[model samples]
Target: MDTTTYPAPQHRTATTTAPPPRGPAATFALHLGAMAVAMLLGMLLLAPVATALADAAGWDQAAAGPEAEALVMAATMTLGMAVWMVHRGHGPRAVGEMTAAMVLPFAMGLAPYWAGLVSAADALVVGHVLMLPAMVGAMLLRRSEYTGGHAHIRARTAWGRAVEAVAHRWPTLLALGLTFDSWLRPGIPPAWTLLLLGAEYLVIGAVRREFHRDRLLAAHIAGFVLYLGLAAVAATTPATVAGPVIAAAWILHIAWDAALHRADRVTWRWYAEACAVIDLVVGVTVLLAL
Candidate 1:
């Protein structure tokens, strides 16, 4: 050797680097894809329910007119999108924007259609065309969100979500009950109402052993027995007596439902709320009929 020692070749270790964040275009595409999928899935999940509600309400889309049908369709689509957006860690602002994007287009077009400036077919076509631009606008308003990594968290507690879901349906439930009353003419017999009330208590009492152990159960049982006796009396009595008894029973049950809902006892709060609506509506209907 030349008497000079060369430094040993420096050893180099390669350090891996994370891939860069997706570009804006890529992010936009990804969000669009996810939204498309979510919309599809939401439709799959919610369409049948919407259809059933429409059927229950006797919507008769053809007779109700295209605008009414379009409104329902828009609502269903928006609700689906909103639900998916929430699941994807979107906040309320994003959800609301998306809802507006889906609904506003269709809703706005109705004014022109009603003014006879556009035919029904033209209004529907324009609405459909506008939805994409509206949705894109909503996305652009929150560009950072779509570009950023998703945050997989829910803003609401399970109970809160349950209540929200029920809140949306209470109006529908009331409508359904009223529709049923319309169909049933004079409504179910008073005896049948008492029998149904007892059945409801049975469900409430059977849901948990804690309910059975509660002292309130004793009163509930007594109420159940009293209902049975009253049912028997209603079955045997004249319309004059049966009508008032049934109306009174329905009115009393409305108060009972309110109490149970406030106490958050026995049955689900949603069920109690629904029962109260049904009780009040049916009771009022009975009173009006009388």
Candidate 2:
């Protein structure tokens, strides 16, 4: 009886409103800041843990060189966590997710090394394996959040837009191709491969209007000089040049990423492209050298 008096049940349209899309710059800033902070935290926490573990295991920190390796691994893992955290949105949940992702690798790698159950090299490999799970887990847990975001315009400038487009499309294709070529050929030195990989990022940064030209130029110069120095060292010793080169490259990559994130011109897509190119170059170079 009351329904007869109700004003036609006041029909309300079900509105499917989309969440506000984050611009490339905002995304870049969020990720970059998180990564930088994560690395800093890793430096504080991981360095000491690695040193203590090395000492307890009776591993010669100098010969085994676990410290630098640990730091690098920790930093990389932290960066990964930072990316996941940003995707998940800022909160305790993000922190928990990052911690879990980071801890898995540390436990798999450093724990074994600390226990003297595995050689440093074996531990490193195992640690890397653990990272796959951690990365996948973190991403899967936050998949809904990442997928829910709106698609926004990438960059305003023509060059910036072009760089973003190519980066999103091809990211690591060149590096992957070169790596395959080197594997098939078997004569190409790894250093040459890595150099090419680094060069790809340099070119990407150079071509992109979104990047800070001065910073990119500086990064290119630094990477080149460091690579050359390592090459010269390898010539005399012929020992594993990877240790030094990788260290330098990682530091350079992190620094460049941090600096680019700070600059107003750069976008998230640009940073992602830089990283993809850097990873490809580094992976190819290492494979070729080996």
Candidate 3:
């Protein structure tokens, strides 16, 4: 009787940990596909409308340019919708990023007209008016896709951080002075002047590890060489004194980038601002030279 009453020992079962949830890749893909479909449908619908409008406006129905323009508008509308979808999560930062990205495509599309590869009518109607809208719309809609991931994606190394800081903190007044002086007094051949200036900055950037050093160097060198070549073609070559001025200006610009990049503590912003400022200065100088 005692042996029969003995209780058996209970065994405990081990619990396994559940796996982590996956990212929203499937949802994102679905949204992107929907956007594409919407864009196509919009294009199809808008083409007829655009044709009708052109006819009403007395634009040549026989002209391929106007028809292409119509298609661009339709596509652009769809693109705008897509942008809205993509940027659903992103804020102003996405807008700025998209705007920057659009620059290259816009330039490329316009090159046909600028380089005489396409007729003015086609360039204006299709490239600028139609294509631009679609591109912009698409950019805006896709902003959501970028979300909050850009910062993580753009994380920099120690060297990159140091260079950015220097650029941000660069002396603005000094740079401005140097730039102005170069334009006021033209002396050296533009090519040599630019090379000297660019080399000086290139060394500084390399040492500092400034943000976008390659682009900065290329821009400076290209700008200088092109300016000099153009100046040579033009009978109005600046005196040798002008060479120093141009070099000074180039140095100033590089310094400004170094300081500015360091000041902001963010390489991307610093790089963008520096580029914009440099481009402005270059444009102004070129106009003045002309």
Candidate 4:
């Protein structure tokens, strides 16, 4: 009777939506940040030992120091980063890709060296240059290998996770690349030169800011310019004055880096942190040498 007039019950289905895709700018920042983190840890844990490694690997002879050390930087950073990529679920493919980046440079440059077509210095320089493209290209390929925005693997130990976090960044590998590259400059590069370039750790983020007209651009540009002027002057100044000037530049630059990292102004803030540590190490060493 009454039930016969009642309408049939309706069933409702729920729809799930995927998260919004990150915008281009955001994507860029995320990638840079990843690389930065990788670099930061790389510098702190491995970069300093690169030189010693070069020496140990039979790269210590005359005219080979830069090349040897550069190779060490590339190998160390590549191996370190690959280990993390693997840790993050990238597997063997990542290891091969990353190692290829280092191997190609050596293959190309060393061929010339053994042929006597180039000096060790020249070959190392070629290798270093070759490495940039190889590493960057390998990193681009990594875009496909990354999953879930990064794999989630639980480390059995805190130290294992810490090591993983440090090793996972390709940016720091690039930064360490820069560190080794800087050593290739003629005459062991003045303390001021290293300081200036170390300050350049901010340049990547600075450039990224250029697109959005970030006000920090002016400060970054102005700082670089001022560094150049000061560096030039330090080139001529007595070591007594130059040492302190270089010291101030590096020490102050590290402080600036920490500040920007805090502000999230640095593209590779993680990279900057690593650079700061390296700066402190080098700055103290340079200061003591002076």
Give the range of the ten consecutive residues with the poorest summed lDDT in model 1: 11-20
Return the TM-score for each candidate structure: 0.51, 0.32, 0.28, 0.45
What lDDT does each candidate get?
A: 0.69, 0.52, 0.46, 0.60
Off by over 4 Å in 3: 1-24, 61-107, 117-290
Model 3 CA lDDT for position 222: 67
> 1-290, model 1: which lDDT tens digit per residue?
48987889964433222232788789777777777665555555455566667777987766777687677667766665665565555666777888889888887777799998988878877777888888888888888767667443343578646634543564344334334533345554547779788668666667764364567787687778877887888898889888888878887888778888898877778678778877777777777777
Scored by lDDT, the top model is 1
Question: Which is superior by lDDT, 1 or 4?
Answer: 1
The sequence of per-residue lDDT tens digits that candidate 4 reaches over residues 97-138 is: 767876688678878777778877787778767865776677
Candidate maximizing TM-score = 1
Task: Write down the TM-score for model 3.
Answer: 0.28
Alpha-carbon deviation at 117 in model 2, angstroms = 3.5
Tens-place lDDT per residue, model 2, 73-146, is 66645643443343333344545675667656866687878898888788778866776566556645765433
lDDT of 3 by residue, 17-119 (tens): 2222334455444544544554454445445555556677887755654335534554544444334433233234453444343333444455677777876
Worst 10 residues of 4 by lDDT: 11-20
